[model samples]
Every structure is written in structure tokens, then in C-alpha cells.
Target: MDIYDEIEIEDFTFDPELKIFQHPCPCGDRFAITLDDLVDGEDIAVCPSCSLMVKVIFEPEDLEEFLED
Candidate 1:
């Protein structure tokens, strides 16, 4: 699937409570993806209010710090 944009994981805001990464979407909503999804090798962050999606750029090892103990 073609994505609307390519964003680095560091550019996203990580919500500890929800355990999700979020970034602003042009459609006035946020593009979101969960840590579980990333850990499982998923990279697409989709906007809840639109069809737009952004590919999250990250390394598998970088996700280790976010893991629940």
C-alpha cells in the first residue's frame, strides 16, 4: 500500500498511557500506531479520521525501551 508520508519514529509523540505513537495528519486527526504493531514488524500509522497513512521509520532494537516489564 502506498503511504501518504514517511515519518521517523522519533518525530512521533509516544503516549505512555495508551502505548501508541502519534503524529499529526493533514485531515485534522492524528496518525497512530501501537507499540505492539511496531514490534511485530508493522510500520504503518493510520489516521483515525482519514484514509491517510504514514510509514513509521524505526529500528527493531529501538523498540526495546518501550516494552512493558
Candidate 2:
């Protein structure tokens, strides 16, 4: 089973910096993301070339520090 299946996502967002490391889509596309527009179960990224959406799942603890700030 996917790790994302076990957690309850409170929010979702995209990291523009992370986009730099994203591999090109099979169609040779690239994309960027921001943190405010993320959804719980949807892809937070897009393919610059194909415009395909990508989904990212984060653990609850992963966002704890952000919530505290």
C-alpha cells in the first residue's frame, strides 16, 4: 500500500524550489508549484511541457514545524 494511504492530510501546497529538482515528464515538460494552492488529495505540481498534474503526499509530522511557526 502507498504510505499516503495511512495519513490524514490537513492541507497541501507546492514548493517552488522543489520544482527545480523535478525530473522532466516523459513528454519533456517542467513545472513549478507554490505552497498556498495545494490540496489534500490532488497533485500539487504541473508539467511545464504536458501540463500534467502531479500529486505529493506528506506525513503529518512533516508539517508540524510549519504549523508551529
Per-prediction TM-score, please? 0.93, 0.37
lDDT per residue as tens, model 2, 1-69: 122122223333324444222433456654434333332324355666664655545554554454444
RMSD of 2: 7.6
Model 1: weakest 10-residue lDDT segment is 60-69
lDDT score, residue 8, model 2? 22
* Candidates' C-alpha lDDT: 0.93, 0.42
Model 2: pairs clashing at backbone N, Cα or C within 3 Å: 12-38, 29-49, 30-48, 43-54, 43-55
- List CA RMSD, all candidates: 1.2, 7.6
lDDT string, candidate 1, 1-69, tens digits: 879999999999989889999999998999999999999999999998989999999999888888853
State the RMSD for candidate 1.
Answer: 1.2
